[model samples]
Target: MTAPADVPPEFLDRLRPICRELPESYEEPAWVGVRWRIRKRTFAHVLTVDPDHQMAYARAVATDEPTCVLTFRSPVDELHALVAGGHPFYKPGWGADVLGMVLGDGVDWAEIGELLTESYCLLAPKKLAAQVAGPAGLCC
Candidate 1:
């Protein structure tokens, strides 16, 4: 199967199962790339940001080349710790709890799964959220 034009197939392949395992979550095309949603809220979104066209992401990461980015929600308290080191992670401007991760080279698939699971818990209803285990050590 062909990958979507905006993001690489390998990235999607890695992400799909993690999101799929969440209760009641579904995948759909977003305006720029792809997103996984629980009910009506988006838990995770992956897209390619062209430095020339997507200035916000480009400026945040300070990259001259195109970047594949994954944006997901995190507990507000954990946001700082996640983005502190900087490069692969950054707090996005739009949401208080939203964080963006640069997806390429040496990326950690296990961490991504944990983050996405936590993200799903954040947006999902209590009943639905409890259906799946939260990330290790994190109480969602």
Candidate 2:
């Protein structure tokens, strides 16, 4: 996918709080990546090795990356809106070609928590199974 052009106003409105609260767990080394961290560890990233400006958010760690890269189904109208410039990224787990599902700019903070919770659940160590916020009450 190419860089995105328009930032979704509604999505940003809801994403700020989660970004504020998710980073409270760290006081030592600090997390890695561009933005968004959980307990001082990276949970989301604006920078990427991917050339499309494709951002990544945690959806369960895959390989060595802290978060899975965002991907979406191709040929969708929302993605088509980003022909010029915008932050290009997909919802992790969905492939790079899928276009209908765009992540980063249009999601709310509660949704961000929900998304992170899901990712944490996916990548979370088996020992933290009960502690990691998965699907139940992540928004609260």
Best by TM-score: 1
- Residues 2-111 of candidate 1 have per-residue lDDT tens digits of 23328988999999999998889999999878999999999999988887777887787677788889999998878898888777998777899999999989999998
Most lDDT-accurate candidate: 1
- The global C-alpha lDDT for each of the candidates, from Candidate 1 onward, is 0.87, 0.36
TM-score per prediction, in order, is: 0.91, 0.34
- Where in model 1 is the C-alpha error above 4 Å? 1-5, 135-139
Please give the lDDT score for candidate 1: 0.87
Q: Global lDDT for candidate 2? A: 0.36
What TM-score quantifies how close candidate 2 is to the native fold?
A: 0.34
Q: Lowest lDDT 10-mer window, candidate 2?
A: 25-34
Query: Candidate 1, which ten residues in sequence have the lowest lDDT sum?
Result: 131-140
